[model samples]
Target: MAYETVIVEIDEGIATITLNRPEVLNALNSQVFIELGEAAEELSGDESVRVVIITGGDKVFAAGADIKQMASATAVDVSTNVRPSLRTFNFIENMHKPVIAAIAGYALGGGCELTLVADVRIAADNAQLGLPEIKLGILPGGGGTQRLPRLIGAAKAKELIYSGDFISAEEALRIGLVNKVVPADQLLIEAKKMAQKFAARGAVAIQMAKTCINEGLQMDLDRGLQYEHKCFSLLFATEDQKEGMKAFLEKRKPNFQGR
Candidate 1:
């Protein structure tokens, strides 16, 4: 499907969503959010695509939610819009297939929130990340409140959100907010490499692992253990698991049919 705010390209089991609004620093307008949801759904449904990358073109990953649109939205209106954005963003995180956030330039406010949802994030060395929602007398309406703490712990998330200050990629990595930092020119190169590497793995096992961790996060300690065991048991029933083991013993790469 075509999108006005972003471009989608799929090849070699990798799907890329390019934020197309370089003119506006790839700001997250309502249209962008809707299109983002559509793009994510498409990537998830396509069996040929094993990995997905969300990124901005050249200038910026995103400057965050379009303030122009935010400026005109009332509290109720804002709530309605933010809900879908949050859902789509979280959907990306929860996707069975791994999603990579390839961030360059500025990833601020909603932009940074969007990146926070990815299974892995690779940022340009000079890229800037911050949650400056407090600067607008608001908080990170997206999953920033929930995901940030999970990614970087409570105190660090608080400091970044409370201060609303931009931190360099090095700082973000040190705080455990991102997986790796690369040169700006190598951002997409490295992200695609990682995505393809993940795509080459056993899809079912990868998906199950993601589910186990996500479900465990919300459950109590005792329940989390039960949930993890359930996830572990479910894997034994899948063909991919059997293939994975066979391939390991045979010293060959497993061919996962995503069963």
Candidate 2:
């Protein structure tokens, strides 16, 4: 499907969603959120798509939310317009297929929050990431406050958010905000490589594992273990699981149908 603010491409078993508003540094807006949610929903329902990558042009992942859109808005306007946009992030996070963020340049405010929704994030060496909402007399309303602390630690997240400082890709890596940082030119290549690795796995198992990890994190250890156990046992009923085990016994790579 064609999108005005974003581009969606599917190849092999990977789907890539590119934010296409470079004129404004690919700033997030209501339209961007709408398109993103549509793209994610469409890809999630496609059986052929094993993984999804969200990215922007080489110059930036996204600078931030469009300030102009919010500048003249009242609290009621923001609640009516901006708040609903967060559903896109939630959709991406809960997608059955893993979502990877290939970030370059700046990923600030809402952009940073966007990356947090991805299952994995790989950034360019030149990338800068932060939640600088406080600098604008606002706070991150797009999951940054929640996901950031979960990814790094609460203290680090607080420091970054409170200071409104941008962290280098290396610093982000050190703080565990991003999975890996590569040369700018190789960012997409690395992202695609990781996506391909996921594509080759048992799709059902991969989705189940993602569910277990994401949902399990919200529960106590005992409850989480029980949930994991249930998900694990449920997979035994899938053809992919049976094929995977048989393939292992036969000393061959398994062909997963994602059933």
Candidate 3:
């Protein structure tokens, strides 16, 4: 589908969603979130797409949310205007396939929160990331307070959010905010490489694994293990699981049909 604030491209089982508002440094807005949710919903039903990547142009992933759209808003506007955008973020997080964030330049405030939704994040060496909403007399309205602490530690997440300070890509990597940091020009390439790796795996198993990990982490250890075991047992009913094991025993590559 054609989108005004974003671009969607699907190739070799990978769907790339590029935020495309270069004039404002690809800032997130209500329209962008709506488009993103639409794109994600489309990809979710596409059997050909096994992995997804969310990115921006080389100069910026996204500067932040569109302040112009929010500056004159009242408390009522927050619920009417902003809550739907948060729902989009939730959709991205709950997507069936894995999502990777290919970040380059400034990924601040809502931009940083967007990355937190991804399963993996690859950033360019020149990237600067943070939730700087506190400077605007607001907090992150897009799952940052929840997801950031889960990625890094609570203390680190609190410090960054409270200070509204942007961290370098290297610093982000050290703190476990990003999975990898590559040269600026290689960001997309690396992201695609990772996406391709995921695409080659057993689709059903990968989905189950992602579900087990994501959902399990929020539960107690014993309950989490029971949930993992249930998901593990459920995979035995899938063709991909049998094919994967058979191919492993035969020393040959398995062809997963995503069944």
Residue-level lDDT of model 2, residues 64-161, one tens digit each, is 99999989999989888875568899889999998999999999999999999999999999999999999999999898899999999999999999
Q: What is the Å distance of residue 138 in model 2 from its true position? A: 0.9
Task: Report the lDDT tens digits of candidate 1 across residue range 147-214.
Answer: 89988999999999999999999999999989999998988999999998998888988998889888
For each candidate in turn, the TM-score is 0.96, 0.99, 0.99
Error of 1 at 187 (Å): 0.9
Candidate 2: segments with Cα more than 4 A from true spot: none
Best by lDDT: 2
**lDDT on C-alpha atoms for all candidate structures:** 0.90, 0.94, 0.93
After superposition on all CA atoms, what RMSD does each candidate show versus the true structure? 1.2, 0.7, 0.7
Query: 1 or 2: which has the higher lDDT?
Result: 2
> How many clashing residue pairs appear in each of the predictions shown?
0, 0, 0
Q: How close is candidate 1 to the true structure, as a TM-score?
A: 0.96
What is candidate 1's local distance difference test score? Answer: 0.90
Could you arrange the candidates by lDDT from highest to lowest?
2, 3, 1
